[model samples]
Target: MLGARGGWQALRGCASLPRAQPAVRLRVREALGAREPAGEVKVQGWVRSVRSQKEVLFLHINDGSSLENLQVVADPSLENRDLTFGSAVEVQGKLVKSPHKMQNMELKAETIRVVGPCDTWSFPLKMKERHPLEYVRQFPHLRCRNNMLGSLLRIRSEATAAIHSFFQDNGYVHIHTPIITSNDCEGAGELFQIEVSWVEKLPETHFFNVPAFLTVSGQLHLEVMAGAFTHVFTFGPTFRAENSQSRRHLAEFYMVEAELSFTESLQDVMQVMEDLFKTATNTVLSKCPRDVELFHKYIAPAQKDRLEQVLKNKFVTISYNEAVEILKQASQTFTFKPEWGCDLQTEHEKYLVKHCGEVPVFVINYPYDLKPFYMRDNEDGPQHTVAAVDLLVPGIGELCGGSLREERLPFLKSRLQRLGLADAYEWYLDLRKFGSVPHGGFGMGFERYLQYILGVDNIKDVIPFPRFPHSCIL
Candidate 1:
């Protein structure tokens, strides 16, 4: 059963797709990049514009491959009622050099076919009109047709690839953590408990036989993997059950988490975090310059030079004590007054970034009581703190959060026992019972990272499907 007789033979029927001959199908990107004339080629895309003149007709089409649309020139006789904005079409054309100064190539079509026509009267988007982001947000299913969201999605895709490459290049094993877990990593209890819809008749029964909830963070799971593989990471969707009315919180979001083994100091963790951010930013800028330019040119003009300066220099670092002192001494009054032991609020974080010269800053050494139990405890006189750090950027308050995890069995056991999570996390304690080393890791909010790089105001705009308090549209 395990050999090729049953294993490979059973899947042989569905192993590979059917091989076929090639056709003259060309993507808009390829068509636009043609140097000389491409004869008898076919291009298919949705119509972005259809203009009719007395002598000729002009058509602009895009196939989601790039931001730039390919120009199609044809005789006025090819124009039809179905050839409107947002309609899908196929053109048998010859690609040639364009006379226009803006673009390089244009498509000279012999025949045009309307594969899918758009009902322009009922369509929400208009031809050549730049709709506001909020107006297009109402139509989530169709908003990708808009230029801004398309650019955003393209940049997001590149950033994701760059992050994965950064970890792989550094010899880190990528792990797929579970979506449903019993342990709440943050211990804040903001969890979405799972239940069977059909089991509503039996109110007392449990679905998984225990209280299972969507995982908040993969940090706890990555800690387990770190013991085996020295460096490990996971990037996936994480869920939270909050009536999130703010722009920052989403019911479902993504987190990029990494764990390291035998790391003695908190700086080791901070260095990796910094490197990941800079590498991803550089890759995205290099790969998708025009898509990135769309936002920098229109959305946030001042962000361009600030980002250049940020990439040129090192990020600033300060302790929680210093940050609190800085906030207290600032001329601007905070809504929540700055205190030594309390957690830093958004206003406090923004002020601290401003105080640090508008560059990204790492605020470390948080109060032990204010942090989770898993952080390594630093024993000091009357004022104990943990080795935790938060990377704050110019626009976004907190982009990344990390800490040196408690590797000692006795320290972790005592802390978990005090918090009444010892019984539930016995598997986690067992990792320390064996061969445990001083380990640390960090988690970066994917949307927050995108928001920081692009200077996006709302967190909802960066992500494709904005899942928040009263919205879950297709």
Candidate 2:
């Protein structure tokens, strides 16, 4: 049942796949590392541990198949005996009872099959202990050599797949937003500019002819497509030039952005965000129990518990003013002092989540100057700006950010004018004038969520081939 996908009907007459050959096989973990198995069995894996004593050799082998590895005992008398660490080999032997306590069962190898022998000079990773920081730098190649790292990457992949599947099943159209753009969506002055020499040869007159920058967020472009399609989302790389070398910051990161059209209010956008977050957390927990266990033991138990709590509890919603008031009264330890008009720093965000038991908190009604022009104007308070929501979680500062878009052309135009961004967003202004309906959406940093779920400390570790301030390793 575990091997086949479509049950008995799909494999009715398929002779190629035998009933004995399951879709996936599980190795006997008890037969690991100098442990003799109870009977005869076939063992296979990469060499993990090897200890030789004159005539006999003991081997601890791993297949990267599971957390547990297999042990093979090799004799020096073998005709073609050649093997080392990182070598690929297969062992045929009798599964006998184990005398060694390290592994439950041991394999009495009758024959050895060496697929490939790893050259001693070429293998850089030794069995000796390696420092964490140095290992991360030298770890690009040998990371998969360890079981825990492999498990974390496996879980990360599953979570990514779940993200796409969750949106696709909900009838969300996948939109491909441009990475290079003319307008800055966040207005935070963090965009990475893309410059070329096209205008360099044209003298001083054509110096400003070509202008483009890597997009910090795909919200504005996705809004253009959201008006046509009821639900549209973009999953791609977003860049920021800010040189903050914190655990939560990254120069280049993946953003899962969605814009829902014809929305009732900001509440609708928040609800969608809640749904997406819950789905991703639940899917990862359900699918990766082993990886979750490893992450809990080695990384941070608080991160895993925080995600679980978020899935169960009703997310707390508070306005920016309310948050400011709470920060003023709270006794939590925060490095940055929170003020009414000032932006909530990482320390403040972390403190708020911890106060709420580290569950997801929706901070809404931000100051107009803090948020962008696309948000719907909130006319209730003193500041009549667009409605915006930022979902803050434990470990990660702002996991998700969304706002109800301003559908009115005049208000959007005025907001653009006041922000001194009219020239850059003339095309975006066209969306409001041309049959724009009530639309709202949010963008979640995919790597940020992965970092939280996996309990990984740095954002660079979660993303493959990360592009940070000082490093861009292929």
lDDT of each: 0.91, 0.78
Query: Can you give the TM-score per candidate against the true fold?
Result: 0.94, 0.80
Pairs of residues at least 3 apart in sequence or in different chains that clash in candidate 1 = none
* Candidate 2's TM-score: 0.80
Off by over 4 Å in 2: 1-45, 51-66, 70-82, 88-124, 128-134, 195-209, 302-306, 332-334
Off by over 4 Å in 1: 1-23, 199-201
- Per-residue lDDT tens digits of candidate 2, residues 1-474? 545666766677677886553222226443543332344467677887677878887877777655656666768664254667778778777766666675566677877778888875667666534435236545576666666666767787788888899899999999999998877787878877666567446443323465678899888888888868999998998999988878888889889999898886889989989989889778888878877887776677666665666688889998899889989998875687788888999888988888787788999988887777788888777755458899998878899988888888998899789878887789988887888899889999988888787778887777656677887666
Candidate 1 at residue 45, lDDT? Answer: 95
**Location of the lowest summed lDDT over 10 successive residues in candidate 1:** 14-23
lDDT of 1 by residue, 378-463 (tens): 88757899999999999789999999999989999999899888998899899999899899999999998998889888888889
Candidate 2: worst-modelled 10 consecutive residues by lDDT: 21-30
Q: What is the lDDT of candidate 2?
A: 0.78
In angstroms, give how far residue 416 of model 2 lies from its true place: 1.6
lDDT, residue 100, model 1: 91
Clashes of 2: 14
